[model samples]
Target: MGKLSFNRLKRYVNPEVFDFDTTEEIPPLEGIIGQDRAKKAMEFGIKIKQKGYNIFITGITGTGKTSFASSYIKKIARTEERPNDWVYVYNFEKPAQPIAIELPAGMGKQFKKDMEDFVEQLQRDIPKAFESDSYDMQKSEIIKKYQEKKSELMEELNTLAKSFGFVLKDTRTGIISIPVIEGRQISQEEFQQLDEETRKEIEKRAAEFEVKALQIWKEIQSIDKQARDEIKNLDNNIGLFAVGHLIEDLKGRYKVNESVLKYLESVKKDILENIGKRVNKLEEKVLEYFKRDIYLVDVEGERVGVVNGLAVINLGDYEFGKPSRITVTTYPGEEGVVNIERESKMSGRIHDKGVMILTGYLGSKFAKDFPLTLSARVVFEQSYEGVEGDSASSTELYALLSSLAEVSIKQGIAVTGSVNQFGEVQPVGGVTHKIEGFYKVCKEKGLTGEQGVIIPHQNVNNLVLTEEVIEAVKGGLFHIYSVKTIEEGIEILTGKSFEEIYDKVYRKLKYYYGLLSNKKEDKGDK
Candidate 1:
């Protein structure tokens, strides 16, 4: 075939574009499925912070790191109690960190101060009540005068009773004694004994005095009631006014401590300075971490070397890159596989190395019963030196399964999706980059007709394949298959239809139209 000049080359037609209304609701961060491990990690970090430990979450963009972290933090903030509260700092990706401040559970300082003042006023007033010279003395004087007036009225009733001819009795019958005159003179001893009439006369006088005293007592009680009522009203008015003044005074006194203010000022300065220092330290740490032969692409999309002598990459523009050294540093060999029989538990180390490894080994018959052994070692093959993203989680699952099943996955086809223990395939992030990365490799290798990528069906909408990749696919040089479950993915990756591979389970992979499965189930039942 004759080579065509650049000027004579035919231009490709672009797809006709029209905007369509998308009423589809974007799922909340919690609704995201198949990221239980990542979500749990974020939750743990939040718990650590709640226990007063600062945390830093590291993950590639679109891995839901920020969303998960923020949501978890917000949950903690909503439930916990503290003197001061948490603040969310977003836009850390920008110059100014956008922040949301949350107040604590109880009343503010001003209100607390007012309460304290109210108690203090009560304490002071209670003591003054006992002190005779205090404001209560006015009420006491009124009481004393009422008592004196009542005594004088009782004295007048006694005089009136002497003039009356009857004596009053103390019993409820209200009986009175009347005088009786007897005409006999007796001896001194007999006279001393006195006549019944004289005695009766004296009893009658006593009864009259009791009646007069009772009437005067009733009158005194009426005056006393009026005086007591007036005093009570005065006391109430004073109390109300005092309480109001105390509240206002306490509020006025509730100034932020000057020393605390100064200390906070210093703290703010130190925090900013410390943040800067940490930024520098983090830069150095990241640089050192990646120093061992990694090929990182700079912000301009140019390949750059990472080594001890090279300047540290700026965090602002640094993207994911693969490690330069293709070293299988995790497990040495078959000896590296975990002994399941020896320990029924999976170590934290294994748990951190992606859930796929644990599931794959546990699921396989070869590794199932006898120490269900498996190595925690895994990495992206030929992924020389760039930051790895979660987009490769599915690939990790496939590789892990291949290891467990002793089945070699074709390196010609790349896979990208998350997987659960039930062997269900789930959606992942960066569908575009992952596909393009494989596409780049395939193009360099002279794409065989069989070469293709297996991606989750949910990610199909995100397929904005580059022109070159599209051309290759159309030309039958490459292909792409969308699978909803792990069974479908395996079929796609192995170039065997589900029916041909696992005939019995093939029906399970059939798509159910118009039915939505619970996404929570896909998130490891979290």
Candidate 2:
């Protein structure tokens, strides 16, 4: 099995077969370098608009799955029409079921303000209508008519009482009939002095007069009730006049919106039913939840111990990727590598393991000359949410290395990938998303052709970029580089070869080792 015939093993083609002198002289292949099947599948999924024809992007973490999905969506969203704003209003008929109304963009806020203004105007004008001179005059007229009617009823009762030898009198106890003898009212003691037969006759006549007076009193009570009803009707009519014009104005404003017209009608009816009630003002203001901030964008200058690390922020229904500054600080010590995120309990176990791998990488690369005698603290600056992946392992390493070597990495570029102890850059998920995210930031800050992203070489096939990014790349406004090793990434970041950086880092570690050794010697001597 190990041996092969000369004809089979030594098959060779003529040099004349190729037209180009060298590979560099030939034009590069078009489109992506690999994964033809993936690219085609993505294109098909993105172009199809039918429901249930969704594209399921599956890959290990850091493969750029979310990056691809979000980039395409955002690109398409830019060209689409703005969505309608939805609002819920109180349903007077079915209070438990609030009605949902859809309004054109920005119209929702206008509708809300208009309703508030209507209520305020009603509060001001309704009270004025009730307190006006015309309303008071009308009210006084109704009271005057009721008083005249009561006077007439009282006169009729007095005449009836006189015929019965008892005159109707007005007193503190109310209208009463008193006994009268010889055309003059008599005291209770004189009335009692009369004989039993005379007293009986007087009592019978007074009882008869009381029956007639009771009928007149009932009539007077009915008139009082009628007057009250008239005054109430006047108040209702005045209230309606004060608020009807306001409701009509609001209806005119939302003339074409059937839902708004219906809601306003309900509101008007409710207001008139309970005229003097005050409506509470809105307590919360409309806040924009999805907005861009330049804080996470990359700066224009290079700095030591700092590298732009990419990350994905998922806020369900609105997920996005952005860049975070990963910073490292190194000093002479035996503590190896200290992850500030882990120390503060803001790092997941995977991230802690990634940091531990940094120690392994440092020892493997530079420990032959001296023990890895350095204290390195790594952190993602301006980050509050806990970091949870090994995706930024390469980014953290670059920052640590830059800190150790006193080298500055370019701020215009971002990086994502996990690294092994051998310093090989390994693939991480969301590569497309991370790259696109950084591209967006650089674009906002203004692309300078020098801005780009360095990703793991193994993740090259994960790219399915938006048209905007593709155009930017075609115009040389941005770039993307796939790296196989930490050295390759560092060279791109610092604009220096891997050997030069290694020399600088090794010398610093050697210096640290010597300084610590000298201090120990001095202590032992003392």
Candidate 3:
């Protein structure tokens, strides 16, 4: 077969032909670039807003799946009137089960702030109102009235004791009375001198005084109850004065949402109940960091056993495209293919499978009759995280084949696509983001029109690129080459026929096998 023309092999993109200074000149893309099909499905998902219609955005990660869905939902969310505010509140009936109060669109923030302001105002106002002289004076009047009633009860007890012919006296221990001769207490000796009838009469009178003392204590307890009830009433009146209008104003703001209104009412009561208790600690808010791109496009020269591979990486709460160099080295051994990532336990099952398939492709092409005697090791450079997917399979195979054929791969071109055992290029996810990623790296390194990406032809359908990429492609400052088979990719990379390169690889494998055979024969002789 003829070699792929140099023109068809590398597409050119001139980023400067556009009338813009930098990418900042282009407006930010509104919706997903190449997913018109997903748009319809996503629109349906966003519009329904019903239960059980939840959209599961499943594609490969870093295909802009999460970002696209979020932006699209937000775009559709702006126009339609949906009350989507929610607040977690203490449920009085079930304190452990908090209630989420839903309010109007954009009203959750307002409600939160309003509630905070109300609490802060109460915090400042309630203490001051209780501390005021007027409140203290009213509280003292209640105490004074209680004390007057207590004094009257004590006076009644004294009068009752006098009627019993004993003088009553007040002491810290309790009320007491003594037998008196006229206005004075009788001496102990004189009391004994009295006849038995007189002593018995005195003891009975003392018993009557004790009963009167118990009645006075009961009356004092009644006054204490009245005083406590009166103070509580005063507190309620002051609390209403300080906080009632504040709550009413909040109610008016959230009148559109009955759920929010109900929540606010409950909150008002809770605030009153929890007054004087310091507020609970505020919850911590998470702040997201901006992650910039970290790959550089090599737009000049050529290197053997090196091919650019695209991958997805997650940083904090966001995902982005990362381009890594996959390198391969081959030797004559029975180990077949040694995957460094697999040995280090940094590759996923799918990635391990891809590496295994690389050995299969080599076996089919180079050693059909006898065992494949070559061993190869493949590694993704600077990769520490667990790598998955067969997306980089084709890229890695290119690097291996280049090493075997001793042909240099063009450094300017980055590549992505999966490969089957038949060496057929398969479509991968994030085709668009992968393109943009290499494009940015190339642009940052100083765009060379010769730089481009080789992608699977089947993935062309999934391409939805940004305006800058389109402009660069149109202007011939950048390029995107779509290939169908590994043979076709090989022809483009080496600028030679697929048969010519494979023949070289085949000969090299045979030469190694021939040496192994000779060494075995010499050993038998020895």
Candidate 4:
């Protein structure tokens, strides 16, 4: 318990068993490095293709997450075909709603042009067809025949009107028969001069002619309608002749694309009907925000009151663990363990509880012999978002103890785990992520073979890491130590036996107690 064995401190992966000089000699492992569980999970996620089954690649920053994800996704994308482009065109049936069409890439713009050209060509050619000599001659011949038949019918009607003592007259209303006397149309006064019997006879004859006149008018209307129908049919044929080729050409070009072909068919029908409508056509910045130059990596120097405490930084979608410098200062007061984070309202309830636990631990361990008269202030230096969880309880205690003992801790190693009143190191969450986080930082700062993380011994089972981290461990470039107690961690950090640090802290506290007792005695005498 006093001094930990080297094997117990670190579970080293001996490179000799691999029978290879370097990791390059070994085939690259599929998926993430040593994480067999995570690899299987990732494979399952890839095959499922369902919503809410996304794979979350979590670890420390600079752990090759971005690089690996990018390369892997790009490789898969290359094997698949490029997606077809979508185009939206105006809907003729429902003007407010537009229709969407899928076309081969780069074909949408051409389709828009073709539609515009079809409208423009129809506008130009339809007018020309109607004005052409051939079209005019055919239309004129049909009208001439209708006019001749109408003239013959009107002559028959006029002769019948004369036999009935009436004359056929063209007026604004229509062809009408007027009563005539002596060879001229009769005035209203002359008609009145006629006898009642004569008037009755005249009215009877005029009624008979009126029926015949109605028949002639019906015949003339039929002839006129027939002529108009012939002209309309000629016009439609000319229009189809003018633009049918243009539509057929578009259909042939996009025949292979079903969506495009359907869209073109609609266009053909619409153009023939409406004639003319309208249509129309990272990571570095992330590092800059969350990463501070001072907080990026661990330094390789010993300092009292300052310990590298591990923590997880959560950026919503991305969460990574990193080391924060936990610092402590002691003064002559009975304020107990003063958590500066709690004082500044930046510490969570759990973290405050952990700090209170520190007081309990110190009171039991060191204050049993003398009154605990020393005031210690513990702080998570340079932290802004506030501290949470008891994960760093062990770290804070290490910093507080180091301040009391005036012992310098190894700055290269970062510690994570919560310590109870009995000083037993308890497990914390995200142990795998925390270890990889420090490993990445150490790798960036240059691994000195001594740079490592101290995790709770219980969390050793959660060590699913990357291949690169495993390779580094195999080569002794980095390490991960699992400890069962604060005593074991203090020995690793200060490179001295825990008994030595305990003696130093005890002596300091005893001296402070003597000073406090003498001050109280002097005040009583006064």
Candidate 5:
């Protein structure tokens, strides 16, 4: 059929090519969910910072150290309207070197201003107590005088009643009269001297006066009670206002002195000592440079010192120059060593020096490995210099693998997990931060449709993505994926499903073992 002119004919319609930029939409912070513990810690730290305490968050790299710190600071800055300042420092490469940071020295001044404002507001609300209102004071004075007068009148009335051989008893209806002498006889001369009509008129008038006096006394008592109650209430209100004023005044007049400074000094000393002990222990365990055998002692020279696990000779108490080398002989079973060198490099001195050391180490490693063909470098980012545990091994391994593969792992995708020697991925710390770090990065990068992070499946319980991230995820700007194994991680990174790639790896492992099994079987048969 004339060579079947297939070249001239189009085989079929052109295959459709789907273009999806995996890095296009950075995952919203919302999609980077999980990590309640880390979120809670961050929130607490923010609250503490607002109350005037500097915060330090410690965790392994890829566990969200920087992300949580940054997020918390951002939240506080956004929500709180205060004059307090916020400062963020990150990318420290050397933890052993001091980091110099400056804080506001005017915090006391600002506090005073705040107190003044508070006092002004209180004074306005309670002007009567703060101001010398003469009306109130006068009312109190008049009430006191009336009470004294009422007491005197009552005493006089009681004395008159006793002279008349009558006892007066107080009753709710008023004072009642009772005869002290029961059925007592009266002198005829005294009875005759008082005309019957005149006597009857006098008794009636006396009884009426008594009734009027009792009514007057009750009225006085009522007025006195009312005045006293009012005075008591006013005193309480004024006293409370005075207390508020006193607090404000004290706040304004507060001054830090030598004693306070000394106490602070002691506190600083304690903190430094504790921090130093921790550093020493960590150095002993993880600092490779400290283990070099650099100093040795010679018995012939009567030396009695050791350095870097070697006994050192005093050399007549000489101060050696830079790059000095020392040699020493070992005891019978020990190997002899020589030519241990020292460098004269001096580090910077500052408060919080450890951060510098950590930063320098990480920075140097990063610098050396940048454009790395087959290597990766990592550090405990934003840790403020502390001993992070071994939970970051798997993340480190993945970073190394990504570097080696020359694959650009999206910054939006942070990972946290541990890895065994066999390369099995394991769970890790601060799952929240790991998620949030990538989420923040994504947010900063402008959310695209494809942004997300891969984390350990076991860390699902730890997910506590912030509200912003959650909202963004709901809006479809971000996503989060959980993985259990290295294979799954590889699939996520490579954009290929594990179902498609796992069989090849499984076959390879099986084939290698099968060959060994066949060789053993043949040997047994022979």
Candidate 6:
């Protein structure tokens, strides 16, 4: 537990050194840096192509899950058959149930355009087809044929009525029969002068003529119906002829895209059925909604009790990681480490536990010799939502230790790792992203060779970083340290050994213990 070797007390990251101003082009990232097992998992997920065996990537934030998945899937897609594209079309059978059609990649956009152009073209062709001289002449001929039959029916009825000594009359009140004598309508006086027998005969004969007139009207109604059916067929045939060429062209173009061919056929019917309706522009709106801005990294600065910790926020399908600034404040009291996050309900169970673990570590190390009485608060700055994870526990302890020892940690570097009461650093998730987030900030602010990150030694195998970060490290403009214990982190951040720091911290605690004791006794309090 004592007299540790200088080499054992520190494990330098030792990034590759190079001329700061070299113009050599750093190669593009061909693969993830240190995650071989994850790479294999990715391959297995992509190759199987089976149902219900979807891939679920599990790792701490900043471990490069999104980056790895996106790049790998994109690379795989280039060689594999592309996924089908989907489009929403208006359903005619069930208007509320919009139909979803799937087309091949790169064809959805074209199909959508073709539909729009079809809509515009329909507006021009439909009126011309309806207004053409041929269409009008054909329609007029049907009406004239029906009218000739109606005239012949009237003439037959009039001849039959004459034989019955009655007139077959057409009037606004409808068809009627009137008494006739010698090819002329009879006056009321003349009708009364006729004998009762003659009058009854004339009335019976007029009733027979009425029956014949009704049969003619029935035949006329049938002819009108036949003419309407013919006109409707003519209209539909003309419309289909105008649209068939446009649709068949698309069907031939996307013959390999089965879904697109079906969609085009549906579109053809829809364009004719709804000549007055507009085409949908849904893809444009979706693209506009998904357009977003990505923040690359965190800013660098030096302050006591403040350290940069990595965190991730998933915006549904899209995800990103940034650095969280953790800060701690301490004062004299009988209280222990006060977790502001826990008290305000801004932290999760694991995070609350991580802070408590630091208290245990502090008591076991220094309070064993004296009363560890102090009031301190630890908080994650600018954290608006509940934070979960012990990954930043080690960083929080570092910040607390800096505040207690009055040591200033470098702002250019960030850290991620969990710690225990034994002061051993444990592995954390998203080690790669945490390093890269801080690196971007440092790079933006100008990475002084000193800017880098400290991570747990066990987490080294989990790293998969971007090419820019790799090149920066190689050029000596950045670094990444892997520490196994808190002492190494302390030495790296403060440039002082744990023994040197503990010596000063122990003396300070003892002096405070005695001072508090004297005050308690003077006031006759426990």
State how far residue 71 of model 6 sits from its true place (Å). 56
Choose 2 or 3, whichever is better by TM-score.
2
lDDT of 5: 0.43
Q: What TM-score quantifies how close candidate 5 is to the native fold?
A: 0.26
Clash counts for all predictions = 17, 12, 8, 1, 36, 3
TM-score of each: 0.29, 0.48, 0.45, 0.47, 0.26, 0.45
RMSD of each: 46.6, 41.8, 42.8, 46.3, 44.7, 43.5
lDDT of 3 by residue, 1-526 (tens): 8878888888798877888888887876655557778868888767775788777766665567677777876877678777666777678878999988876668778877887898799878876776666865775566566655655665576567778887553222334466887765565688899999999989887876677677677777777677656755666777777888888998887787787778778776866665423211100000011013233335568888888887643221233455687899988877888899989976765578789999889888888866678878999987645566678999999999998888999877889998888898877777776788777666766787888889999778778889999999999999999999999998887778998898889988887788788888999999
Per-residue C-alpha lDDT of model 2 across residues 198-289, encoded as one tens digit per residue:
89999998788778678888998898788767766776788889888988998998898999999988987887766433211100000011
Candidate 6's displacement at residue 102, Å, is: 25
The number of the candidate with the highest lDDT is: 2
- Inter-residue clash pairs, candidate 3: 12-478, 13-476, 13-477, 13-478, 14-476, 14-477, 14-478, 34-464
The deviation in Å at residue 209 for candidate 6 is 99
Across residues 1-526, which tens digit of lDDT does each residue of candidate 6 receive? Answer: 7888788877775555654444455644544557788889788878996788888877777767788788888888889877877888777668899878777677778878987887788778766665566865775565555545554555566667777777543321345566977655665689889999989888787777678667766876676677656655665676777788878877887788766676677777765665322111122222222222132223455677677777643221233446667888766677789888789866655578789988888898999867797778898876655666678889899888887877777777788888878888877666665676567556545667888889899778878889989998999989899999998998887878888888866776677678788888989964
Clashes of 3: 8
- lDDT tens digits, residues 247-338, model 1? 44543543343432332334333323332222233333333333432333121111111100011112222212121211112221234423
Over the stretch 148-169, how does candidate 5's per-residue lDDT look in tens digits? 4554565566556655555444
Better of 3 and 5 by TM-score: 3
lDDT of each: 0.45, 0.78, 0.74, 0.75, 0.43, 0.71
Model 5: which ten-residue window has the lowest total lDDT? Answer: 306-315
Tell me the deviation in Å of residue 389 in model 3. Answer: 0.9
Model 4 steric clash pairs: 33-467
